[model samples]
Target chain A: MSIVKRVEANDSWYMPAIFKGLGITFKNMVLNLVGKREMITLNYPEEKYEYSPRFKGSHILTVKKDGSIRCTACMLCATYCPAECITIKAAESEDPTVEKFPISYEIDTLRCVYCGFCEEACPVDAVRMGPEWQMPGINGANFVYDIKQLARRPQLKGGIVSVVDEEERHKAGI
Target chain B: MVSLKQSLKSFLQKLDNKSRSIYFLTQGCCSIEVDNLCSSNYDLQRLGYTIDIDDPREATVLIVSGWINPAFAEKIKEVYSQISGDKAVIAVGACSISKSPYVDENGLKLTDVLPVDIYVPGCPPRPEAIIEAIRLLEKTKENRETSKIIYGAIRELG
Candidate 1:
């Protein structure tokens, strides 16, 4: 059981409390006006809060050094996705070494949960969670990002090269 | 005379922009993020956006957040019809835009009922994205022809 102390309420008791509250408010106002304390509000457009590298904002399809897409159309990402937003149409690759490549890779941005499962499921590091989050559009059609938009959008420059080496993976002999 | 008329029009536009009020429809989890936008951290009021909760008629912008059921669709249409003067509708989050995680076969999309000016795509888009969408809406309102052309060119390039 907790102890309770009885205190008498008086007309004089409220005055000191009111003055103390006002004093604190006035002090804060003066401090803010004089620029003595930093404001918590972020001037959004001018100054953006940088999220960490692991932040799952948007998807980016990585490319090879030769400016080709890195995705091998393994279907692991599509299987793992809870929302099933990713659609990959696999086609036979022309290269003797490579087996298959996605003829069409589309992600319905409006349906995506940004769960980052696709990034983790990829064995080749073909998919990554990019830093960009702003993807507002005027139409529903624009929300469906195709392979070209995912990999070779102007914002990503030419393409983001995968850090993982194919030779290193083969040498590991999984 | 033409220059003077243009100047007066621009002045009126600026005044209209300043007096714009927003009516936000809270439907799901996305409403929480929209609520965050009004707080001191985001401070949407600084951008001349006032949330009008009492009257839909007074709102110049309607922010539709989250999934809309068939029952709410009729109510949304009624509210949309009630809103007077120049109005813009914003669809915030994946649910509002495409009704994600919900089967589309029976889903009632916001776009089918009302024309959307901006589509902010995310499970629950960050407040920054919503702000950017509002800014884009304002820009389009200011110069529709030029902005459309620019936006089209950018889209084509992408």
Candidate 2:
């Protein structure tokens, strides 16, 4: 005999759960539709949520005290990049103390996975992930990044902890 | 009167549909290429060029997106060969230009290896520069041929 599905009283089962979820969702939908609550999406260009000081966004090659690229042509970032996106040609500098500089340093933005491992691999704090996140372009070639472009990036005077949304930062202990 | 309006609609439709087609090929290490080329504000089309996925022999632009490996070299060569005679090839990123990293299986010097018509330099180039590159190509060459070729390439990420 086929056991007619035994419906338990305690279990209003799937329908009740679905309705409960629908009710919450419906309430949220109305709330969002009417802007009953404050907005969450940043105004973007006008306003952006704060990110970590170490937030991996744009790449910046920091300079030494002498205003030279901190990279010793170590080839660490180039090797570590899974995308194989970095290009560098090392040259011996005339100043023996400085040693080496990338005669040329280039990154094909089209192919970069943006993993930021290159920044991590650098022994010297030469290349770092900066807070400037806006990066967009067309066709792969236009995305190739240059050293000058990476270096001249505006320093986010907004301190590292400065980016975390004040409200969210209050929520987070860090 | 109906026919005139209909004709005007079709003409307007064609004018609105006018878009440039660009195919990107990856040969070098690719980083930030899309960030530098296709973001909203710096949309390359704003510079009067569109990126399309159609065949290059007729589409007019072919962008080699990354570094060129010997294995992939044959395919890149074929793609260039298949593009229309007036079409141009652009190497967009550094990986496509030089095998900066250690080359075991997935790297090669593309700029030195292939005949690139233009080089858009960047780890990922700025979108503005990318737009500039497209405009430069348009000014430099006129699309003369009109045939389409479709045969090799399009393999999985190796």
Candidate 3:
């Protein structure tokens, strides 16, 4: 069974096909010049691309209403993280409500895969993927994001409050 | 001594005029973003950066993307040595910078072999991030303060 189509003498003509291709190009050029067509090129320095809310880029540590870190230092995120980029030092909390808290929480951005597993593993809504993707730095030391850099960076503007209710969690005993 | 400063100034001026050629030693998915940089959408050429595929000697900037083993580390050093006059090195993606999930006892980082000027951290950084790294390099070059080490290297070469 021959599925190949035979080329007729009429089909061999090149001029009409060339003209059709050129016409499309001409139309596009005209449309672009007339400002009818949107340019695909994004002037990066002058403009920026906005990723969706779900877009995972950088990691952020959520804070409680009392201006303290929301993380209870359960080490769930560290255990679940495939990259093992997250390092947390668990310490006893002064507050009666919270049993433990991370004395020092650090994430090596260079080692992180950004799988958002940390965010998913977090029971207290402590860790999340932030909207800001720009993480370029000059030195290797700068890539290792500490608690201050992660939770208390000026970009977060005091801190991003978690949706998880602290009182509800306390009642539920999470 | 005055001639040394004069020569260095001339070299910097030459660098400013010439379009920087980049040699990308890619080993992971970050290559996709590097390809995007050359595409019309990103248009790396607009910023006077051309991808050099043939020779490292022609490259002004060396971009190392992904993890490096012991053998790859030696190769990177060789490539770095080949790159001539006031060269800059950029470490792109998580793997190259720190080996990420693939971290092994024997794994070698880009920083171990080369002095990385820009570290663009991402799983696979967007092309925009890479562009920003180049922009930072450009700013540093304009200042002439950071290239003092390169000037010393050039003097040693002579």
Top candidate (TM-score): 1
Per-model TM-score versus the true fold: 0.84, 0.42, 0.81
- Candidate 2 local lDDT, B54-128, one digit each (tens): 565655577777555676778888877877545567666556645543335556766555666666554555444
Model 1: residue A94 alpha-carbon error in angstroms: 1.9
Expressed as tens digits, the lDDT of each residue in B1-158 for candidate 1 is 86775666565555555326888887788999898888878888887778746899888788998777888888888888988767789999878777655445666778898998888888788889999888877766654543344445444443
Arranged by lDDT, best first: 3, 1, 2
Per-residue error at B30 for model 1, in Å? 0.8
Candidate 1: lDDT of A161?
98
TM-score of model 2 (CA atoms): 0.42
Choose 2 or 3, whichever is better by lDDT.
3
Q: Which ten residues in a row have the lowest lDDT in candidate 2 chain B?
A: B149-158
Each model's DockQ?
0.53, 0.07, 0.57
lDDT values, one for every candidate: 0.82, 0.60, 0.82
Q: What tens-digit string does per-residue lDDT give for candidate 3 at A98-160? A: 889999999988788788988998888999999888567776447778999999899899999
List model 1 lDDT by residue over A1-174, tens digit each: 998867768654899889989999999999999999789888888889888887788889999888889999999999898888999999998898677999999998888988788998999999998989857877544778899889998889899999877667778874
Best by lDDT: 3
- Deviation in angstroms for A113 in model 1? 1.6
How do these models rank on TM-score, best leading? 1, 3, 2
Give the poorly placed runs of model 3, Cα more than 4 Å off: A1-27, B1-15, B142-158
Q: Model 2, which residues run further than 4 Å from truth?
A: A1-30, A33-35, A38-49, A154-174, B1-158
Fraction of native A-B contacts kept, per candidate: 0.64, 0.03, 0.68
